[model samples]
Target chain A: MGLIPRTIHDIDTPAAVVDLDLVRRNIQALQTYLDGTPVHIRPHVKTHKTPQIALMQIAAGAPGVTSAKVGEAEAMVAGGVHDVLIANQVVGPAKISRLCALAQNARITVAVDDARNVQDLSAAAVAAGVTIGVVVEIEVGMKRCGVAAGAPAVTLAQTVAAAPGLDLVGLMGYEGHTVAIEDHAERAAAARGALGRVIETKALCEAAGLNIREVTGGGTNTFDITSKIDGWTELQCGTYATMDAGFRPHSGHMFESAFWILASVISRPATDRVVLDAGRKAVSFEPGGTPIIEDPSGLEIESLSEEHAKVSLTSQNPDLQPGQKVRITPWHGCTTFNLHDTVYVVQDDEVVDVWSIAGRGKFT
Target chain B: MGLIPRTIHDIDTPAAVVDLDLVRRNIQALQTYLDGTPVHIRPHVKTHKTPQIALMQIAAGAPGVTSAKVGEAEAMVAGGVHDVLIANQVVGPAKISRLCALAQNARITVAVDDARNVQDLSAAAVAAGVTIGVVVEIEVGMKRCGVAAGAPAVTLAQTVAAAPGLDLVGLMGYEGHTVAIEDHAERAAAARGALGRVIETKALCEAAGLNIREVTGGGTNTFDITSKIDGWTELQCGTYATMDAGFRPHSGHMFESAFWILASVISRPATDRVVLDAGRKAVSFEPGGTPIIEDPSGLEIESLSEEHAKVSLTSQNPDLQPGQKVRITPWHGCTTFNLHDTVYVVQDDEVVDVWSIAGRGKFT
Candidate 1:
């Protein structure tokens, strides 16, 4: 059960609350599953953006933490996590300059798909007299980023080897396509194929005389599949720490909604409809329509404006009135986490602590 | 022309940039149109969230500003704004207490659509020894967060009048349904009808012995319509300061896109597809759809992940490449503004100043 919010009544509405019990349970589940597995866990910080959560995950056996931006890496370093991997490409001098500064103290690794970005990182690293780890990202299945898997990976690794102040650690690939699918079998099959591509790229790199130490890939949805694989080094899972509504029901794993937006009923205009103080601004209404509102029987989130969430009472929702607090589970945790600055760490009915999302809006 | 970007190139990518020239034009347009009219201008701070913009609007003859939440009002007051109307309801002890505390400094007003909430507000106001302004929110066209127009509004106004420490301040009704319609005449006709309901409620409140002083309603889209109406005392326009993609083309006035997410091309995976550094997290991708990518020929925003915007090229665009900066115009400015913490206020190419979004994620 979540913590009782006995002391949380005084908190204003539309607050982002993370249930501590659920968080611990979620982390414990992941640790238990990967306890003896060869695959190491480097939890991605994009979902929480809080250094404390990453530290907690580190304490729970995560080797390090992953960030999507250079600013996030700098923030995580500030949060005292010395080992950081920026899982996305770092382009341009403005960011590369930050990367060079970050590499001065921490063990910084960054993903690169393009040769130009790799060259830029090399120049920045050389300028700072810091040797940075490089992970050539391969185009597994999510065609958004990354170079082609096999020969292209070798070429990138060769470039990394040739560049001064750069060490080719391994490769990284994100199986984003299969991460949130509904069907279990299809997602598992797709995960196998995606991870297979990464493994293939790794072999090609190794065959080309590249030393592959850590192949960081996989996410919350496919971590199990990658853990069961032979050559996968680490899992950069983010969502298993705080599950969102986007995760479909499956027999693969059990992850509950650990984080939610605590909203209050502000308008009770009609018997069949009500409005909450929180809407798209507070809750993460992803590409997947509206977020799931925690039980107010027979009431469904009809639509959301910028500041108001209009809920339709299809049946008798007599208890739903103004000032009553409610919880909204978001569709996606990463994007939702970006919208908040602080998280009210709570138990069922009471807030226990508050953690600042230190790396929020670190897009630069 | 936007201010020259002499120093903007060094600011990194995936940053929110505001064209100061366009912002001034948008505000000037609203002020010019509303000048000498019977209606009043009260710019809603939900769009910009910066007290500087609110101050600018006030300096441009806006009587006051409107906040979606009490926290936003507090933020504005901290930025030296005294007259603020939180045009949403203030229910619950926590919010009402804060509102009361805020009223000690700022001339605060709020909207209500229920009697119990009115009683609660009255009790809170009486306890705080502060008089609060109350406006009955009539359900005009949008069936959300508002009471019925005529008698129900009168009933609520009577409750406001009877309650201690509360002063009835006429009514508020927003015609959100017609704001984004493509057809101008239809939207204007709907705006007239919507404002007509609020006007009728004011008459009903007067006939029912409730003295009405300020009738505040209407938004950016319907401000033109409300200005033509006879009884609209004030206009709470928000989006006129920074426009979005959802607003249909209207010949009534020219409103340029002032706010943009300056994103870098992170990946050029294929000749026909490129990924932007800014995604759904950076740009405000509302339920409406993807935001418009400016100046990219034959390229359309195909999809957005949490951290990557995928743009598909229908035709070969030889010029577009990785590391190039692009501007994304959001579909909803208010929600978009909430996602960002600071906006680089640029004239054209060079950034003139940077404003911290003081009210960002002020969900309460």
Candidate 2:
């Protein structure tokens, strides 16, 4: 099912390219994984930052969508995703008020690690005359968020349960540190250790007279490992839907690479070196560097400027010309997706679907 | 003239905070520098990526605005900046056609280093029934774009002169490598050496019976050094309008810091460590790293994550608490502007203006 547009050469280079067939297949595979498991999937929208992809996950039987910011959650709601969870803390009156207002239209939940944040969120929800779900974030190993796993996490859960206008909704912990780990066995072991802490924290919360029902955690990297976590009820995997080249090496779950940055070779000054039109400005450098060049036999990307990428080749590939276009699969798909406003869903070579990153650039 | 909406705590954290008073003063300072010089100011719009900033530059007597992409130029045109130049190469049929269409509404010019690109641009402009201005880029040590200094550049200029429906405007070179050099004398020497090559290239073009009028180049770091180049007539400074914390140590100019990413402390688990809401997603890591913490009492940003920044204070800052908000001046102002949809232009503590980063996320 390739569209193969007649004017393929007319497309701009460094544009976010998506293979629709691959994306659909990726979605189908993730769906199959969740179907066999008891874990409910609530894919993180922060990965794609697009309502179209979020809806696709929902269509594939996701319970809801997860976002890192209240603005993104609000945008997802506006774009027709009914259930949204801010998987991070919601602080300040502006954001808390926004999150509470969003609950008026859709199901809105937020993660909390500290007592002050819960108090602020409760006051804001009370002011807005709405009750918001709050998930106690348990610190596993990431050390970025949440309180200490056992006692401190239970204490925070108690605070959330005792807070006014706040519904304590289970537990949440992000083992993001294990997402990009290379070794399968080691990654699985680390995931088990981290998720074990989350499970223990949930047990402590239950012993402290709190009813825990929905324990949500896990990313695309640890979906398999976390699927077997004893108490985890929901998987927050998002990147599996639009797999990048970096994930190909680690993911035992085979997912076709759907994301590609179409860039043109603008300069070939020396026979050994060529420059692409796309650079840090187009694709992000969030995953430490630029995309790995897919084709052009002997070339290696050396460095990136704002508008150009310097590539050195051992020998020039006969297929590559100065003006020829090539597709680049970025190291981190999530960050690259956020950098573009629109992503073209392509098959073969033609563009069949145009999807706006509805929540793109919503950092606030 | 300060809006002072309420207090610093009243506004949301992790928002793009701009001091309009500082921005105006910076603009005036740049205007003052170019008062007696023959150099034409064409402020680069890639930094702010906003039409309001471009309009302000025009109001300060800038002849035109420069953009790194065709989409940016289009946004400026829509925002009412009629004179625009795509300071980077415009390759492939889609971008060329778009550039030609943009030329139909505004004065559009682009930089070129190859003969084939010149032909492609000419063909697009001819098909669109418009004439496009072309600037022949010379190699000036950055090695990113441009042909060799003298004869090669002259030959490219000749090709541009011969091309149909294209006007050879001038010569341009970017000494990006020398921009951020910490040593003042060494930086000036490097700028002189690089601009010397550009001057020699212009003489070669003159000898080849080509009239080269405009010679444009210089970033925020090298503006002063390159301003003294003999043949250069345009200063294309972008970041000066919104000085970042990263450039403050080396700016050598009295531009006030205008941009700050306001973020709240989300976590305070340890007595010494505090985590902020802003992280890699909000600010770019290109120039060096994330924004430095601008807390009143001495504070240092140790590390950052996707959603949290682990900030360690040298001593306890009485002002900073778990829920207290702080301001972060990013390392690179340009990419940080692209990460958000709207920037709150603040005076004192009040949001005096809110401008959409209209051209943001236009990676394609």
Candidate 3:
């Protein structure tokens, strides 16, 4: 290519620009925080969705990468990641076949809460002649997707252990409802209370003649608390690598925000208002946490259409005109990263490289 | 090479499925409504983002397609459409160059609200030796992007007329603020009042000796009111082809909802709770209008995680179990279509064809 833009100004507008230094710092910070603990780091690939960054996280002491879908796990394997843990349910015949196909090349582990789903996984694994690891997900408090954390969890683990071509690896329970509590002591108490059932379930499974080797839990918001809970073997923190506005209020001191959406001011309709080219489609409008302009001047995003952000200037005469560039911090990094196909890697405001978000739109 | 799935049961989960018969009927309904009136339809392709669907709308009776970005316009031109309108501001040098490149083989028109952008467009048009059409977008009431609707619009029209290699084609102003008012009389009154400024600006431009031939406004919610209003030439009602839950409250009886997200029940955590494979990533979670399950048997979406929709059964046990499929209607079709790469075209629940969402991520 013809000399890819060396500086951020030469790059196109509405582009996902990533700070490489901050990304490395964020990864290093998480690894450093869990250095003295027994918990291993298995960074979630859902936030960045780029395989290169997953590799970087793996290089920085992450045991493997955690994916939210089977398609994401497949992409990680194709990009040279040896071990993958799909942290969600992989349902239906097509996805089960796809999940089984990935086990032929590398270590593929999936979380399941239903006995029927576990049976289907066993059948697919036997048909494909490959072994797939199973992690029984326990419903701690999130109440989204997990079996109840008691005899139910123990029974599922027993069924997984009895299935053919399947290896019962561990137990998983995410304290999602208590992750972003915003108070350190309150968050600690909530995490401990939610994860107590997980520890109990692990003990129950072990007491029933089962070897539960791992117990995984933790979000980026509660990684510090969950890492110290004595039983969680790994922290599946995804947004730590690319901090967002939503989670930054609670975890700002630990990890630096590295991702930004670079947009151009396209319309200065009035003296007090200037509209940017980025809107809900470019950034995300997550509830209770909308994106903000990085200038920190008296500028505020009033509303968003499909393709434009109507920003009002609280300061008098900001000198913003058409074609002027501004950086925006997205509310939710995972959803915002899903909107773009590529991100420009930057260091010190200079373009370093370009990476494709290979795992985006991998909903199936 | 292999036989495609003939029925919806064989298709993959978390897929965007479009009913071809409903889509054509919606298109025909809108076309029939505007037949006796003098207003022509220029459907916005931002909702579906498929070139094949845009071609279908053109076949029904559309002079051109309206796009929200330059990249979408480029895709339309490459997909055998000769007339395209970039309905939003296209800033920066790279996009301007790309817009001019498309004018080499098609009639390219764009909306502008700033003089600096007009100068840049004129310079780029001259450099590329192509004439571009310009539409001065007036700020009716949306407060997003456009010039003030009186003398300011007239002045911008003058500047556009003086700019070489640019043709002052028409005037555009979207009454987005009042389109979904939910009351027929109130919507009609609001549409008339907002579009009144557009007609006034056109008259003022004509008084100033500018050939303002076209005046465009209206969303799908106020298409009927806008078509009956005097001095309007076209309507840009996009969601009429694929009605969404957000706009269906006001316009449901006129157009049928044509899109559905087919997802599999992946988790049955409790007797009253069943989680689907589709979540915010598969469907949209737009504020004030989140998606709903198509089954009317007392099913409700409680919350959404990244990859799972926590749905609750309002009544006693509804027979939804793991591996069973359900259809979902999205809150907003435009944002929902942006998440998929391809849509499976279905007719009577049979797979008829597959069309790529060619303009899904054309933010620039």
- The best candidate by TM-score is 3
lDDT per residue for candidate 1 within B32-79, as digits (tens), equals 987888787999998899998999889889878999888899999999
Model 3 lDDT at residue B135: 95
Better model by lDDT, 1 or 3?
3
lDDT top scorer: 3
* Order of quality (TM-score): 3, 1, 2
Error of 1 at A44 (Å): 1.2
- Across residues B1-364, which tens digit of lDDT does each residue of candidate 3 receive? 1257889888887899999999999999999999988998999999998889899999999999999999889878888888998888888788898888999999999999999899999999999999999999999888888999989999999999999999999999999999878789998998899999999989999999999888876789999889998899999999999898888889848998899899889888988788899988889887787797885346778898778898877556477888888889999999999999889999888898988899988888
TM-score of every candidate relative to the true structure: 0.96, 0.94, 0.98
lDDT of 3 by residue, A48-128 (tens): 999999999999998899999988898889888999999998888888889888999989999999988889999999999
Interface residue Cα RMSD of candidate 2 after superposition: 2.1
Using Cα atoms, each model's DockQ against the true complex is 0.76, 0.53, 0.81
Backbone clash tally (model 1)? 21
Clashing pairs in 2: A4-A350, A14-A262, A14-A263, B5-B350, B14-B262, B14-B263
Docking level for model 1: medium
lDDT of 2 at A334: 75
Model 2, span B204-292: residue lDDT tens: 88988999989998887887888878778998999899998777777776787888888888777656667788877787766365577
The residue-by-residue lDDT of candidate 1 on A1-364, one tens digit each, is: 1333456665677888888888888888888889988888999998999998888888899878999888788889999898999999887777788788888999999998888888888888888899999998988878888888888778888999899999888888888888777776788899888879889878877877888998888888887787887888899988888888776354255677888887888888888888888877877776665688875545578887777888877565645888887888887778888888888887776778888888888877
